[model samples]
Target: MSVETDSHGRLYLSSELRQKYGEKFHIVEYEDRLELVPIDEDPLQAVREAAGDAFEGESIEELRERAREQAKEDAEAGFERGKRTAEGGNE
Candidate 1:
């Protein structure tokens, strides 16, 4: 998705990204691109900063793999949320 800046050069968030990342992630719109953030910062930090209980016992490599999986899940969830909202938020 893309965002248009105002005449005063203020960055405007893409509602598209917001709706998509509902409870999963967030996108910070910049003049040229967007920065992504996780919904949960994983305050637990028992392992990697992003690992939860399901991964507390995993190896470092395993934890990386799990992080990838979780990121994909969050992205898909966000995309679906965006789709639903695009369909008039009836979902």
Candidate 2:
């Protein structure tokens, strides 16, 4: 469908289109053209759907603890490597 903007630079959509896709839209600009993407009314639900099984069986606290432990291990490993280099030992 063809659409034109008014003097105020606002593009009006038909009632049919609005009913089908809701009132909110995200304007996507490409090199040659612009496209309108409908925005989901519930953003949190969209994120939960996109994440799928990422959290699976683990609680938030468990995930945080795992991340902290991994960071600690990585830091210790890096310190050991730096110490070895400082001592002029072969890696």
Candidate 3:
């Protein structure tokens, strides 16, 4: 199928396409081309499916704590990486 953008540069997908692929999409742009990735209609369900068995026996509080710790660790690692990059390190 062929698609064209309007003067406002907004491209509208056909209903047929929308039915096949969801109503929402993630537009990915590369140096050469663009791609439209369909997004999950129910993101929480997708997360649960993806996270199978990882947090099977964990309580809500335990999950929250783990999330917090992971976020902190990720932030610290990012900060360290940024610092090294700024200090002329290739890391």
Off by over 4 Å in 2: 50-91
lDDT of each: 0.70, 0.89, 0.89
Candidate 1 lDDT tens digits, 1-91: 5667799976555667657654455678999967767565453462455444666576778867988999999999999999999989865
Write the number of the candidate with greater lDDT, choosing between 1 and 2.
2
Inter-residue clash pairs, candidate 3: none
Residue 88 C-alpha lDDT in model 1: 92
Count of backbone collisions in candidate 3 = 0
**Compared with the true structure, what per-residue lDDT tens digits does model 3 show for residues 47-69?**
77899977787777998999999
Residue-level lDDT for 26 in candidate 1: 69
TM-score winner? 3
lDDT score at residue 23, model 2, on the 0-100 scale: 95
Question: After superposing candidate 3, which stretches have Cα over 4 Å from the reference?
Answer: 57-62, 73-91
Q: What TM-score does candidate 2 reach?
A: 0.55
Residue pairs of candidate 2 with colliding backbone atoms? none
Pick out the ten consecutive residues of candidate 2 with the lowest summed lDDT. 40-49
| TM-score (C-alpha, index-matched) for candidate 3 | 0.61
Instruction: Supply the TM-score for candidate 1.
Output: 0.38
